[model samples]
Each structure stands twice: as structure tokens, then as C-alpha cells.
Target: MKRRIVMSMFAGATLLASSLLGAAPARSADAPAEFGTDWHDPVTAAPPVAKPSGKSCQVTLAEAQFRDFTPYKGTYTPPEGCGERWSKVVLRMDGKVKGRQFDRLGHLHVGGVEIFRTSTPEPSPDGIEWSVEKDVTRYSDTFRRGQDVEMLIGNVVDDTYTGVIDVKVTLTFYAPSATAARPSATAASPVTNAARPATSTTRSTPTPDPTPDRVLTPDRVLTLQDGTVTTPRNSERIVAEVYATGSGGGCEEFWYLSAPDPAPYSCKAGDGPYREVQIEVDGRLAGIAAPFPHVWTGGWSNPFLWYVTPGPRAFDVKPIEYDLTPFAGLLNDGRPHRVEVSVVGVPEGQSGWSAPVNVLVWQDAKSAHVTGRLTGHKVGELANSSTYTPGSEHRVDTEGRHRLTVGGYVDTSHGRVTTTVSRSLTNTSAHRWTDGENLDALDAAWKDDQSVTVDGRGPARTTRTQRTYTMDGSITIGAGDRLRTVLTLGDRAAVGTTRAGRRIAWSWLDDTVEGDASWTLNVPRDQRHAVGTTSERFRLHGSKGCYDRSLTSVQGVLTEDRRAC
Candidate 1:
């Protein structure tokens, strides 16, 4: 597949940026019976990063090859021509690999802000390429000045494993329109560093308001240094995002399938198949959210199932966002405060999880110091259970849930602002496997709900969000020594915002993937006759925009695609 460039992000940029996606081509009359040296490149059905219509600037962030754990480190200078303020900022990463290799986890960080997290695809004998695009406008605060950069895609190379990951990352900045320009919005200026060389960050024109809230992303993004954070004294609002992943090819990589001690299972954990990400400030519970159950390309004990179409969000990992506004009152003391993150269900003394955090704050413009009190902080009892049933077909049924609510008031420049946040989470699964684990399957679902209300002298503004994730599949070794897999995965969400009990904006999203693959087991690469089919349907619509489409592939070829909606 040919790579797309983000040279000019104007009209038709979205379609042009649809790398390895869109409609399929004419099919051949005959199909190959055996696995070949090459196949179609990997692709996903997620919507492309929407670009605005305007002049744009592009900067190469990093380029490197990974053969070990050492990370690629460098420096990033702001785009020379792009204005300080922009309507949007888009991130694109293109990668290619060939020969033999295992799937590898990757990360990209700029000035300590983890902007992107992903996993690589196992390469074919010949070669394959893939691309990913994500909207990063909210990080405009971090891009307004020079910063340090780092990236890593840990891999290994030997006589047998030969594939070396090659990738290039870039950022595109789109200029704001005349009406969207914020000429007078410079009351809160961008961070200034005298040691760094000046670039386009110094602007004469007004910058756009990237978000409704006065976002104040610190120039030096925090990484929870010793589980501590020091926010501005005048900060009136706070939010934190966690890019958490379970990996290392150990039991944690397939964390959802792990079982508690003595379940006759190979992998054991203190808790089974249920996990939660929690946030705390000053040793008090502040916020919580559910982490997405992510599956890599080599997941489900079958690589053929994902050689063409991957599961949702597999290519572009998204961070779990937490509204910590209720803790602003306590964090606005100018002194360092203890901040912590913990995954709820992992066993003690075990290692295999990584959670990097980025804290975002909004400061009061008129006051040098803002102070108040945390009125309420409540945490519901955690509900978790795992039942093991042993028989011809051993089974484990598990259920876990938790809830938290926090309220506080911060005296800002405008007035006293009271904020309340409530969040809840639930996870349930049925894991079954035959004796010797010849046949294994899992059916699981998870839900994360959040609501935030901001009350001041005017009508209160509220935002509500409900997110769901599901996985149902099975891997079996049937007659004739044939190994097969049938699986389905889903990622969906519904969001709404209101004022004074009236809806102002809303949106819904649903992305589903299904596949069936089979091949001769315990055979040579050429001798194993492999066959597989995968399809994805993604639909999204609401106040911002609309995207509805479906794609299908057979024998590593995209067979059907249409924007039917």
C-alpha cells in the first residue's frame, strides 16, 4: 500500500488520508490456496482525523528503527510558518515491516506528554505497511513552544526473527479562520522559555480557543514524579488523562484471561478479568475510569484473524480521561500534592502494566491565588466476585463494579465555581475452556459512565458520557488438525452536554468487528493452507460531524467497502 502525505490539509484531505482503507478493488477470478510471501497491508475501520480547511504546516517529529528497548530521543521545534493559534493539530504515524517478527508495543512522548500509544503488527514474509491518524488539538498548549521528544517500539532481531520496525511521525497544524481567531484571547499567554530558540510560537495574530474551558497545559508536562504534582495556585479546574496498557507478552498481555490462584490455569492473578484505573490527590479518592480492553494483532491465539482488519482502536490507542475539577480546590495551594494511579485488580508484587499520566489545568485569570474547600468526597464499596466451576468444560464467571463521587468549590476570577463529578464502572465475563485447554473461549462486557456538573452564578453546565466495550470469541482445534477462530469485538459511546436541563450538543459512536479464520496447525509456513475473512462497520454522528462506513477482507484482500449510511 502507498503512504499518504499530510502536505496540504485542505479539501478532500480526509479521504486522501484514508491510508489502506476505502473501497476495495476488482477481484481475481481465482483465489490462492496457500499462504504467500506477501499480502495486503494492515488497516482498521476507525474514522480518519478530520482536518479543517485552511493553510497548514507539517513537522517531522521523529524517525527511527527499534531492535531493542533503548528509546529514540530528540528535540522538537515549533513549525516555522504555522501560527501560534490553530483550528486543529493532527498527528500521523506511518510504519512498515517485513520478514518475521512478533507484535511490539510502541509509545511517542513530547515534553513528557504521552500523545500516542500503539502496537505493531506481525510482519509477513515479504512486507506490509500501516498508518494511523489522531486529532491532537487539545494539546496545542504543549506545542506552542519547543520541547523534548521520545519514541520507542521495542523489538528483537535474531537469526529467526528478522523484521525491523521502521516508522516516521509528523504533525500538521491548520490555521484558524478569521471569525475563529482570538485576537483578544491572549489574556492567558503561552509559556515562554528564554533558553529555547524562537519560532512561529511568537505571534502577532490572535490564537483560537481550542476548547471551551481555558485549557492550561503546563509547558513541562508532569509524569507523576514520585507520585506528586504541583499545580498553579490560581488554578480553577483540573483534568488528567492516563495512557495505560498491559503488555510484556506475559500473563498480563492477555490480562482479561488470567485467573485467580489455583484455578488449574497457567496464568494466575489476585483478581480475575476485571480492572479499573483510579486517580487520587492528597491521599484522597478523586476520580476513576475503566480502561479499554485492547487486543494486539497477535491476539486470540491466531494472527491470521487480524492480518487484514484489526479490532477497533487497535491502531490508535485512546487515553482514559478523568474530570478532577472537584479536586481543584485542594490542589490550588501552590505546594506539591500527592497524586496516584493504580489498576484495581492486578496481583501484588506482579509487574506488566504501564500507566503514564498527563495533568491538565485551567487557571483563574484575575487572581494570583485561588482557594476553597472540598465539600464532599464519597467512594462506593467495590463489588467483585469470581466463581470457578470445574467439570468436563471448566468455567469461571466474574463480576466487578465500583463508583465514586466528589464535589468542591473554587473561588475564581469570575466568582465562586462549584463542580461535582460522579463516575461508575462495571465488568463481567464468562471464561470457559475444555480439558488441556484445547478449546478456549471468552465472552465479556464492560461499561464506564461519567457525569460532570459545573455550577456558578449562571445556568449550570453538565456533560454526561457512557462508554461500553465487548469481546466474544473462541479458538478451537477441530478435526483434521485444523485450528480455527471466530471472534467479535465492539467499542461504543454516547455523549451529551446540557445547560439548565436543555440539551446543547450530543453524539453517538459504534465500531464493531467480526472475523473467522482457519489454518492447518503444527505445519510448515508453506504447507499450512490458511484462509480468513474479517469485516468492520463504524458509524458515528452528532453535533460535530458524521462518519458511517463498512469494510471487509478475505484472504488478506479487501473484498467489500461502502459508505452505505
Candidate 2:
């Protein structure tokens, strides 16, 4: 049997009630905050103090200029009194483009060696303007007063109709303190030993390769294949891997360049394109996959030289891996089941989809017969839309003990904000599965949260954020198959005042096996009016693995004139 749980809590002071097992306990009015009070404070170190022994200097490495489909390079020379030994060195770039949007990659090189690289901010919704600041303290030795420094700016993409950009580069130098020890002249040189390994004709014996236990089969290469394609299935485990290059055209085109409309597009609207890969078994929907950029390739701006010397002359973008084990049972049938992979969201005439996908399956001569099905699928309608798909599977093996696995995926989205959450529960108990059974099980949960915010106008603003959180817990069976589990987790709470003087509080309770979790938001009342204040309460409960809930509320006193008291 399978079950689905749904819970919702509003923003203001209201009661949201739901039941999965039973009504959760009411939150206490005096409960402490979970997140933190001073979270809004900047978390950066104080500025470095200038040394009294040496003078500080600021130099303009390059002035503003406009370029099109070309690289920008300039030479810089430090001024005297900057000192050979420096404490702080910073590189700053102020840039703005009119009429179009673009993503620029900038590199700082000294004596032919690339030291640092960064990308300009994505075009703002209001306009194209940004300022980038990087700390080059480690490369201070390269800033010799008599030598020339090279700055390279590579335009990755420019969408401006006229293609005009105004950019300026500046370098700030802070000399070392009098009390600080200085390095010798030889140690101050930026160049390091660059020697290649000597060529030798010595033959080395090759080590034996490990025995192969897995098989990889190419299903479909979206970039090479014109339309939908199929591959023969023959493996014990199947994995769908997708490698996406550039932006999957169509609606994705706006991702690299600023959209002319700036309004949200939808897949059905013929303007909003989404990359969705669907998998089918015997012409039935089996699983769904989404394409994400590989960190080494498209995800990162400059992979050439960052941390190590000659890091990677070229980018070798890897593919994202998704487990299709939930549908493994349907494919494990003795007969060769038909499998189909399809790519949607790409418009005609525009091939924005450049995903090279492969479906790999492992084969085992003596595998068990398996059967599985998804049930209780539900989607919640709220400011934050959430979809839940849960499934249960059982494997019949020759051994007396059978394997059972329960898994699900929960995807939540609010406008440009989206979070993907997935969980799996597995156990190998006697074939007596029942409700409330204390079956020794293993549970794993993971969540990926992403949000994109656009400010009307800004020179330096955070426009995008991506974060991930994961937790794993397990229940062990004793010598006689007795259930024994020890779980320890922490809860987070936070209370702070917003810039608008509104008292805002947020709390989260992370429960592993489902218990009563609640939070309270207190609103200040006007003492002059002698009015009693009320606090908002939120509660969540379920039997699923780890249940994570966040409640945020703003509390303030309202006067008769409609102003904050």
C-alpha cells in the first residue's frame, strides 16, 4: 500500500490544519527562533589597514572602450612607492553595455601566465551594468613597478543590437606594514620553475584492468539524432545520462541573452521552452529526466587556469547522471521491452537542444523477478506549486527474504524559484508487509533549491542562487531481526527585523521519522491601545522519512490610521 501527504501553511497569522496520522501539537507562543537573529548582517571581514611604512597607490590599468566579437587586451604598469612587498592587491572592473545583453569572461595574466578569471554579471532586467571585484593578493609579486601586466576580456556572448560596451579596469595596491617582514628580491619574482618531464624510451609494464561487471549502452544522442530514437535494452541497471551544450535553444535562448519581452514564457505558450526528457517502457510513461549543466563545462565560466598550473587547456564537459531504478522492475521482464526517449521544448528551425544522452544498463545472469507501480500522485496548488510522485517495488528472489523499495520525488516551484526533493526507503523483511510495521529500513533524502531574482536596476547585485541539502538515516535489524535505530538531528530557528521595521521570524524542524513539529510567530501589540496580541502557529506531521518544514511570518502593530504602531 502507498500513501501521499500534503501540508500547507500561510504567511500571516492563521491556522493551517491537516491530518496524515493525527493532528500535530500546537506550537508554543514562547518558542525560540530557529534560523538566527542577525542573519541579515554582512558576513565579510573588515577592510585591510594600510601599512604606515609604505604608501598606497591606485592605477588605472585600462580605460573604458567598446568592442564587438573580439577580445580586449591592455597592459598595465604599477607606479613607484607601491613597494615590492604588498599586503593587499585588488582588481576591479566597471562595465555597462547599451542596447544589448552579454556575458563576458575576463582573465588577468602576468608575464604570459594567467592568474585569475571571472565572468561579468548577467544582464539585469532593467539594463546592462555591473562591477566585478577580485582579490589578487596572492599575485602581488607579479605587480612589479617596471613590468607590464596584461588583462584579457573575452566576450562570450553579446546580444546588443548596436553592440557597444563601456568598460574600465582599475588596480589598488596596499604596501606591507612596517612591522611585517618582507621577502627577498628573488622570492618576490612572480615567475616560477617551468620544466617539462624529460623524454625517455623506457617501457613500463601495464597493470591488468579490473574485471567488467557493468555494461553501458548508448540510447540516443539528441544532438546527432534528428527526432526520437530507441535503443535495445539488456542491462540489469539503466542510467540516463545527458550532456547539454550551450543553451537548449527556444525559450532557453533568453537564458544567455536578455529577453526582449522579459515576461515569463510557458511551454504551452509557444514562447516558453523547457527541456524535458521522458522515458517510456512498452509505450508507457516510466520516468522523466531534466538536463543540467556539468560543472566542469558549461556550469563554470573559465576552466582553463584557476587553481593549478596548466589546469585544463580545454573544457571536457561531463554529463549529469540520473538513476532510473524506479522503473527497473518494468524493464527486467524476460522479454525485450521497448524503451523510448524523447526530447521536447525545442522549437522548429531552431536547434537549441544539444544534449548527448546515453542509457546504460547492467546485466546479471541470475537476477530476481521484480514488479513495481507508482500511486497516490498529487500536485498542490499554492503560491508555491508542489508535485509528488511516489512508488513502491518488490523483488522476488530465490532466497527466503524479499527486497522492497519505496521512493518518491517532490518538486516545488514558485515563479523563478524551484526545488527538487527526492527520497528513498529500502528494507528486506519477511513477506509480511503491513501498516505501522517496524521494518528495519534505510532512508535517504536530498533536496536541490534554486532561485533567480531580477532587480529593476543595479550595478552589483546578486541575481541568482543555487543551493543543495541532503540527509541520510538508517534503521538496523538486530541479531534476531529486531528493529534498533538511533537518530540524532538538530532544529534551526531564526528571528529578525526587516528593513521595513516589520518583525519577521522563521523556524524549521527536521524530523527523521515523523513526530510533532511546530513553530510560533509573535506579533507585537500597541501598549497604548491595550490590545491583546495574537501569535501565528504552524505544525507538520507525517510517517515518511525526514520531514523538513520552514515557517516565516511578519508581525507588526497596525494603527487606526493604517500606519505601523
Candidate 3:
């Protein structure tokens, strides 16, 4: 069985009660009350809720699509920032009460509806607390309301459990207004005095609520072109025989005029034989357009051709195209350029121009590799390993290419080292191990006795490190080194392991030791087996002060250039 834990915190004073749970909903004569409004004693009996059969609520949507300048279904509270307020908002989901609305509604019942004024607020598991993070109000309260509700399912019953009940809440109090003077809570309802039997309702308090509305626009339009002009005038429209494919798709036409702003306007997508408006200094409509068949997807605006002049209607003549396509005389100047476009008739204002996409087009450079030998050792080649600089700083710079920095240490005492390599690669194969003139076969194995205790923790014993060595001069390899490739082997080694899970040999590259009388490890290039591991045990060497020891282990892979695996 799984176990669960829960913790709770409650305020002592009854001042600002918003930070505490509120009294349960009022009980109707026919139903039981979920909870009382007073604070319960340490051992007060909890009230029970009436469980009804079926769902508890319902939801609905008013409209689908909304355009700019056009309002949606219902009045929506404007968002803090200004932009387009959703005129019509589609209801994403609706809720319905199956049959019982009060079965689990009792959770809504609480206590101390008002306790924030005099009490010092305390944090609670239920999320009730004072606003200590910001400077604003002192006597404040927090209360929750239902935001959404749904049912849950269990193993045997599909509808045995009710869904989570969400809540929204408002904490009311006075705070310094933007102007610095104390401001009243105009959005909050005035507190009332009890005149009779008390009762609280969702309508108990009024708030300046903002909800979204819904609205939809039409789709489809017709376009026309002049047959006589070899090169259509900036204001000319030609009749097209093509027909729109379907509904719900929106069509947009874009044209340019000589005005301070030559931005295009959009038209609602619909079958249009309607007169297209043109701009002229004299205010005379510039052209007549025939129908062009086009399909419109919801909310989509396509471009069309039009003309514009300078200063609302003066000397600048420019032609526009909904879709940028090459035509013999479409552009009177006959040069390629990007233009602003928008549709007309749609409640939404004209949109901005498309990003500057170059009709012109270019190629990109190549990469390569280089190789190097793994060379390094620990502490004069012996008992303790060599310590890496403060923080094991390792870096790689291959000519003009970016340099990669790695950080780590080599624990040669244990025949293993680790470092962050620039990139990860597979070592297909490797073989070669030479430590000293004695030339002991790499297969030979031995063990050593050791002990460790951090700050007098314990002198733990183990048999992990058995060999150590050093290298002073440079070693060269002429096999593979291309300026394109990067090959860096700080220190390498190769080790063998038995199916029994025992390590046979290794090498170390770097080491870091903190504290007096501590040891580190570091081995060299061709030792082949570089596998480092740590184990901790506690043993008391002194009568007192031995329980404070701690040990940690880090692991990594070695390169083949230094040893055979």
C-alpha cells in the first residue's frame, strides 16, 4: 500500500479571514449545511455534506471568430495591456450537472470568512497566506471560489468520483494607489451589516467582471481585370473566370497608393462583384473590378492588386498584387520590390506587411580534424596522485576553430581519470600497455591495503589501487592528424574486467584533494586500463570525534591514445 502525508497551518486571530477558509455555504431548509462560519475548536466534530446523484453544472459558448474593430459576443473586461480585446470568444468546453449539484458541493463550506484584519497571517498547506512579498496592504484577506469542476474515474466505476473543483478568489484591502494617496477598492462590493439570519451567496459580493463575446465574419470574394490594357494600371482590375473552391476560407487583396502610408487594406472574403475603391487626389474612384474566384480559410487574408499616391492622393503611383507573381506590366516601373498589403471590408484593421523575404538567393564552408598523444602523470610517479590546478582547468584550441574547455581530475592511485571532452566519439578498438622497464605483463594483478576518514569520520580500509607511474619527455605518433580533426588525450589508460565484475588494471589523469594528509591519484598515457571508482567505510581510530566522515565518487571514460582497454 502507498503512504501519503499531509500538513496544515492555521491563523490564531480572526481578523482578515480572507487568508483563512471561509464559512460553508448557507444551508437551505431542505438540505444540510456543509460547514459553519465560526472557528472550530481543536476537537470540534466536522460537518458532513449531502451527496446527490448526477453532475453539478453546465457550460456554453457564444461565438466563434472575431475581427479587429468588430466586437465579440459579450462585453469582455479589457486585459491590463491594450491590443485587440476578444469580441467573441468560443466556449472551449461546457460543464453539465448530471443530476446532483450539492453532493460534493459541501467542500465549498468553510469557516472564519473574515480573519485577516487583526491576525498575523500564517502560511497554510491550503495556500492561505498574507502578502508579505510586496508592500501594499496590511489588513487583507484571501478567499477562493469555484473556477471549474469535473468528475474522475476509478478501477471498477466509471463515474464513482467527482472531478477537481477549481476556485478563484479576491483578497480585499486598501493600498497606496498609483498616485500615492490611499485608494478605495472600487471593484469590490461594500461590506454589509447583518440585519437578519445570515447567508452568503455567489451574488453576495459584486465585482467589475470582464467576460469575452463572440462574432463571425463571411468568406469569399470575386476579382476582375481590364482586358484592353497590355500592362494593367495601378488601379485596374480584370475579370477572372476562376471560381472560389469553398466556404470558411477568407480571401484578401493588396494594392498600393501614393499616400503618406501605402499599406494595403483587406476585404471580407465573399463572392464580390462589388465596386473596388481607388484613391486619387481629386477623390474620384480610380477603377472598376470584375470578380476573381478564390477560396478563404477562416481568418486568412490573401493579397490583390491596387494603387496609391503621395499625401493621401498625390504624385506617387504604385501597383499592388495579393500574391507576389511576375506579370509583364503589373509593375508600371517594371522593377522588383516588396509592398505593403491588407484587405478591405473586414472589421479587423488592415494588417502589417510581410517580412522582407529576398527573392534573390547563396553557399556555406567545410570542416576537418587533428590528433595528439595523451601525456601526463601524477605526483612524481608514486604513492599519491598528482593534483590538478585549482579547479582542474583543461582547454583545447585547434587553430582557427573554437576552443573547448573541459574540467576534471586524474586519480592515479586508483588507476583512473575523468575529464569533460569537447565531443563524444566511439573508440572502435585499442591495444598497447607499457608502464616501466620491468615490463610486467599487463595481465598481472595485485592489491593494496588502505583507509580514509574525512575530518575524523573513520579509517575505512580497501584494496583498489595497486600501480602508479610517470612520463617526463615528449612522445610522438604519426598516424592521423588533419587540421580538420581535433584529437586530445589529456591522459589515457586501458583496463580489463572479469565476467565476475572485478577491475583488473587502469590509469589516472588528474586529482583534487582537500584537507591535510589526504591523497589523490594520476597515471600516464599507455597504461591501457583507466577506470576509477570510490568506496567509503567508517572505522573509529580515536575514542571520540569519528562519526563526521563523508566520501563521494565520480566516474568517467579514458581515451585509447593513452592505454588499451
What CA root-mean-square deviation does each model show from the true structure?
8.6, 25.6, 36.1
lDDT of 2 by residue, 109-133 (tens): 4544343443332222234444445
For residue 235, model 2's alpha carbon misses the true position, in angstroms, by: 52
Prediction 2 TM-score vs. true: 0.28
lDDT of 1: 0.72
Ranking of all predicted structures according to lDDT, beginning with the best and ending with the worst: 1, 2, 3
Q: Encode model 3's per-residue lDDT on 1-565: one tens digit a residue.
A: 0000000011010111111111222222121121111111110001111112222221221222211112112212222222221111111111122210111101011121111111111111122211211111111111121222211110110242222222222211121223433221111111100000111122222111110000011011111111111212221111111111111112221111001111111222221111121111112111111111111100001000000000100000011111111111232222332222122222244332111110100000010111111221111111211111111211111110111112222222222222221211111111111221111001111111111101101121111111111111111111231001011111111112121233322222111111111111122212212122221211111111111111222121011111111
User: Runs in model 1 with CA error above 4 Å?
Assistant: 1-31, 181-221
> For this target, which candidate reaches the highest lDDT against the unseen true structure?
1
lDDT of candidate 3 at residue 464, scale 0 to 100? 19
lDDT of 1 at 347: 91
How many residue pairs of model 3 clash at the backbone?
119
Writing each residue's lDDT as its tens digit, candidate 1 over 283-322 gives 7878777778877777776777777777776666677777
